[model samples]
Target: MHPDDLSAAAEVHRLAFVRQKQSEQWLASTLAAFPRFLCFVAEEAGQVLGFILWAQKSGFRDQAVLELDQLAVLPAAQGRGIGRRLIVQSLPLVREQLVRQGSSLKHVIVNTRADNHAQKLYRDTLGAQVEATIRDLYSADEVFMVARQVDEGARGR
Candidate 1:
């Protein structure tokens, strides 16, 4: 996402994640991280509707493990497939960035409250599956999901 979109994106973050505070600072820091933390926003008619953040996990290597760090859409825009579009659209761009760094995406990891319905979205889009569950990790039980060998899956798309 461009620096100019920070405020609008942060608004979406605030609305999507009500429990989280300091939206501007959180978004600004992540945006500044660049290649290590790739951030993309979905906008229409100059209005930011949603965003997706992917972070390279651990040290960089030939095969990179990425975390689907954060996905947020304005509450009013929810259930309209903006979140799905964010994932389907930004992932290829992320793959291209990794390729330029002489790296390829190996797998993707996502963790969320067990009850969150977005698990289905991850499954459909990234082929992510729940690998583990940590009780009371945050506000509730958190499930760790992973999509293995994404290089092939990513290529097919």
Candidate 2:
């Protein structure tokens, strides 16, 4: 995503989680720290519907874990397949990045509220399985989900 998209992207995040808005500053910092190659924004005809931000972390396994740091769609645009598309379109690019770096992708992970309906999106779109739940982790119990040993080819698409 480009810096120009920050305001709209921040608005999408704010509207997506009304009570727990993520500041534009935080989003800007994340965008700056992670290359735009690892970020995907859903847009059409000059409007941004949503975005997905991912980051890579090293693990004990000889590969890296790709974590979904944030994924959100404007409340007005929800349930229109934007979330699913964001994930489906991201994996091959993610795998390409890993391959370009001569590294392997071990898993793709995400953490969300235990009761979040988006959990199903993660599971259905990315083949993620709930690994654990940490109670009261952040305003609510949080569920940790991971897709282990991902195929070089995308499956959830």
Candidate 3:
């Protein structure tokens, strides 16, 4: 996504995540980091329908990890698998980078508001696990539910 896409991206975020604060400059700066940071926009006929932002980081245990920073789909675009496509398209790029760096990436991790319907989509449809509960972290009424991708090779456990 281009720098100009930030405003549209932020609008998508606003529609998906009510309390989150995001700025155009922040998105631009993030995109400046490019390959180190993965960002994607779902668009049709020049209008953005959704966007996702994520980063690659190395765990202290020496494992490569993809942290899904934010994912937002326009309300009108929901249920079309746009969110899934963004994730699916990005994961291989993240894995390829990890392999090039000689690190094993066991899973992709994301955290969402505990009560959000998106959590159900992640768990039941995407097959993510509830790794942990971060209590009262984001807000007094909000709980963070962590999820991890369980790919076949990472399954046994």
C-alpha RMSD of each candidate structure in angstroms: 1.8, 2.3, 4.0
Go through the candidates in order and give each one's C-alpha lDDT: 0.91, 0.81, 0.68
lDDT of 1 by residue, 69-152 (tens): 999988878888888888888889998999999999989999999999989888888889999999998889999999998644
lDDT score, candidate 1, position 126: 88
Q: Top TM-score: which candidate number?
A: 1
Winner on TM-score (1 vs 2): 1
lDDT of 2 by residue, 6-26 (tens): 888888878876777555876
Rank order by TM-score, top first? 1, 2, 3
Model 3: lDDT equals 0.68
Local accuracy of candidate 3 as per-residue lDDT tens digits, 1-157: 7777888987887777676666566677788886667788888899999887877765323475666777888999898987777766655665666677676565566777677666665554345766667767675433333445446332211
What TM-score, computed on C-alpha atoms, does each candidate reach? 0.95, 0.89, 0.76
Angstrom error of the Cα, residue 42, model 1: value is 0.6
Candidate 2 local lDDT, residue 124: 79
* Residue-level lDDT for 86 in candidate 1: 89
